[model samples]
Target: MSTDTNTVTALPMRPVVADVLREAADADPRLVVLGADGQALAAGVRERYPERYIDVGIAEANLVGVASGLARAGRRVVVCAMAPFLVRRAAEQIRNDVANPGLDVTFVGVGGGLSYGTLGPTHHCPEDLGFFSALPHTRVYCPADVVDAAWAVRQALAVPGPAYVRLGARADRVVHAPDERFDAGTGLLMRPPGRALAVAAGAGVGIALDAADRLAGPGHTLGVLALTAVTPFPQERVRELAAGVDAVVVVEEHLASSGLGAATALALAGQWHGAFAAHSVHTGYPPIGDREELLAHYRITAGDVAASVLDAVRGPGAGARR
Candidate 1:
């Protein structure tokens, strides 16, 4: 692993999406932010970039359309809002204007997946990745760590056309150090090697890490593989990793079919010409509850990931492992 940790004396760093946005806005001038109010952690963008920050008053469609117009008018804009409303309500606008025209606009969606917890499934963002991946000229990146989050925000701002990025609801963990390099269609190996890789994204990385830690022992090492960039699916890099690992356990906080697992499987079969053991598994929407509760109930924690690895290697379900 790259040992150069490009870190600063910042706070414990709550992995706030706003922190990433604030960091991006500090460097870029063409950024215009649109939102319908948000958590206090996100208010810093409003405070710091007052002229560029806009409160669109809960109108989701207008949020996207206005951003599309701004991009056409030579502004590198971002439509920021809660995931459910921003995506579902404005999907038409997104499809018709931003994505169709390949406009240089981006959507920074906060509270992706069940990060909204008690808000219930209505606010769950399980399909956002699938939705964004299907749209023309749309590139999605769900950062698996704080460093990647901040870096991804900046990269999306620089790239032309519609890009979507996921930001979790809480002050999450920092999956990597500051200096770790990331780009579109790339992934990070968040753990040491010689183990099955849990290819995952967003808060799913945390879950996989937990599963890995808990499941390790007796001829198994569950490694955490973090894929921050989703759309345009890092085919070559992912194939390279998939070619070497004994097994790939894909976990995501999104739907089972179109989430990272599906993406990785397609790449392996179509590009790498490889197949994992039948023990490979994918996670869809779990029994509903808070994020922690949901992860535990669904066996998505690090312990769970590790357990899956163990099962694949030695458990009866794992079959013959020499």
Candidate 2:
């Protein structure tokens, strides 16, 4: 579980996002970047496109409102802020202003899940997908790496309605190839074909990939389905992925109640009768710790995922262990 810099490149999602936003701004003069004291994360965009960047101080509500207004005025606006405040604190504006009118605004939520781990439950955003996905006319994205992060920015800008792109705070382990084509509503298969499939999104995608690798040594191969776009749930694609798998395990950093786990369950309900399991944080606030510690504490790590997949594939009471 060590995030060794040598083994994998840890590309921070914020800077990659800023770079992509700056490129988008260059193409369209009407595209603007708004932040709620998130200037540090969007510094690259601010420096490259000074005229298009706006910092709305600490008011998360005002941040979303300004973005909505700008979008209503025919400008493509990208609102950047910590996930908790952007999705929870300014939820009223998100629901009323952006989603209600179906404005072309992209809400970039940084530090998603436990990215702000040591900052406690107040800063952690584990329920963003549930809230945003439930809103009408809104698209939700949880990109796993830099490539998908950049692609999400482009996809959000192209969409004519509200969109939410959830990103981790620190650098993420690369999970996609440079030449990999990003299909908005389709899940990417990260591992080789196997009897079981691990469906994951956001940071959990990387974790799921690692679990697949670990399972290989035991002669157990698991397919990994990494989802970039969560809302606009991609029901047909998910059903296809689960078609012939002996077991399906849904892994995510958020709570199982309303995250990828829940979405997958809803999608395959009455369709697939194979072994189904969900690995994610259960209800309630997690104990304070760093990202790795928190993941282990909640049993959402690669080892935990591997164990869960093994149990599902081997059947209940098999007592699979990492």
Candidate 3:
């Protein structure tokens, strides 16, 4: 909350995650960077925290396994590796070794989802959210931008259990986190006091914010959620906020079923008591294609997410229907 609401400032450093790691290392001596040698992000952490950083070469499973072991031995380990390789390649180690048994490991998933959009299907880690969401006692973090990405790392480090953090390949425009909105599971309401709302998860927050900027009105709101950690969702807060909004549209960069929409449905089913209608259109994905194609194909862009909000307000067959 140190920064002002409207003032957007860049991090003092170029790559902000480095500062985050350094801060965590300073905060706790037991913090270790468990990384694969090939990762640029991992290499950066290794250069600075040589003593506390371990480069385990190319073993994604070993990357997570070592972290689980470290956590068991009372050390806090951040397993940094390629997004898809770390999550998909190390599925068994993550599921069985950490998530299933509820081990205290944090997988720092780099280049998640379309961040590696051009890297092909094999490199995409869109399922990380779905993977962690279903796991028992597992927490998930999908940061909106670099600031929240760094904050997410801190949040996971503080937790004494398994956490998954998925970050984009490169820096994203900063999303303001003035107060407790940046806290674990809590979401930030970017636009204040509006009848209609667009809910966003991860980088989709930026898209929602952009749409809100263009859609000027007294009754239009943009509710962006960083979701630095999920599982112990900000249920009471979400329920309270969702109840008052006229229209609610959920957005995420993952498959619709297991991502933001699913979580929002569960939150509502547990008596959300929201103004939004029961029927809604999700940012769905089933076709195997590039991220842009996937988002456009699924109508998940800022304009599309925004259009859905207006559609929800007008109903199934309103004059404004497109």
Candidate 4:
């Protein structure tokens, strides 16, 4: 995140995705968009480049197959659908057809995490990172806002192998500048350096930012590290940021076991000998509610994040040296 106040603007990620794909289609005939009857969200691309868009009508498995086939035929395909179905229902196709063969396929999973909260567990997706990252030759990204999402879309178009871009259903508050540089396998520092560092991904970046502000009210300053890319986890960057911090707290919407928390812990293993706390959705199915309710239920709110950081910094067990 840049300190320059005039550079950032909040916007919805859905239209940003549509605009990026449509522009890519216009520039390159090789680019194609595929959907699983989810054209409502991608109406921009469908209306502009109808010939390049394909609606698979709720068939997630068939959708991946068609995208993979097109990629194999020298086409860059972008598969758009809800995260739960796109990643879970079409797991085999993604693993065997796209990742295994190293196809130029980009799976854009919308409504990531509890964005589809009212639809129940079947519609919620918190395991995409776990499953997708486990596969070989695949790249995974969860952008914080429209700017990062656009950059990710462009990167996916140029990358040689398979990639997954997880997005939320609603708009996100801007945290980075429009001109912020994005690269795979890298992390961004959203706030100034502090005694404690909070690592977050996707929507959680905003949450962590809010938590940092809340902590400031109590005479505490916490730094925030935003991770736009999940797979090919930025280990070196994590270590570099973790250095000099009294404690590190990782917050995410996904389950702690396989989400950014797990990735950060793995990255700092044997290197960062400091207190750590993980704030994320637990390892069980969450109760059905709206996004806010579910986030509160899982204690993924800004207040909870601030409390966790406070605990990690001054708790009974936080007596170790950095």
Tell me, by lDDT, which candidate is best: 2
The Cα local distance difference test for each model comes to: 0.71, 0.83, 0.67, 0.83
Per-prediction TM-score to the true structure, in the order listed? 0.83, 0.93, 0.83, 0.92
- Cα lDDT over the full model 2: 0.83
Error of 3 at 77 (Å): 1.1
Off-target runs (Cα >4 Å) in candidate 4 are: 1-10, 217-220
The model with the greater lDDT, 1 or 3, is 1
Worst 10 residues of 2 by lDDT: 313-322
* lDDT tens readout by residue for model 1, 1-322: 2211333122222345567667667777777778776534346667887988877788899888888888899988877788888889988998998999999887888778777877777887778888888899888888866777777777787777889887777655665776888756567777754546677887777667666656556455666667888888887777777665566777777765777867878878855432242212234545658877875665556656665666556545343332
Expressed as tens digits, the lDDT of each residue in 1-322 for candidate 4 is 4322234355779888888888888888877889998885567777887888899898999999998889988988889998998888899999999999989888899988887878888878888877888888988888988889988878877778889998887666788788998767667887854768888888788888888877774335788888888888888888888887778888888988988889899989888787888878886667779888998988888888888888877776664773
Model 3 weakest 10-residue run by lDDT: 277-286
Clashes of 3: 0
TM-score of 1: 0.83
What are the RMSDs of all candidates, in order?
A: 4.8, 3.3, 4.9, 3.0
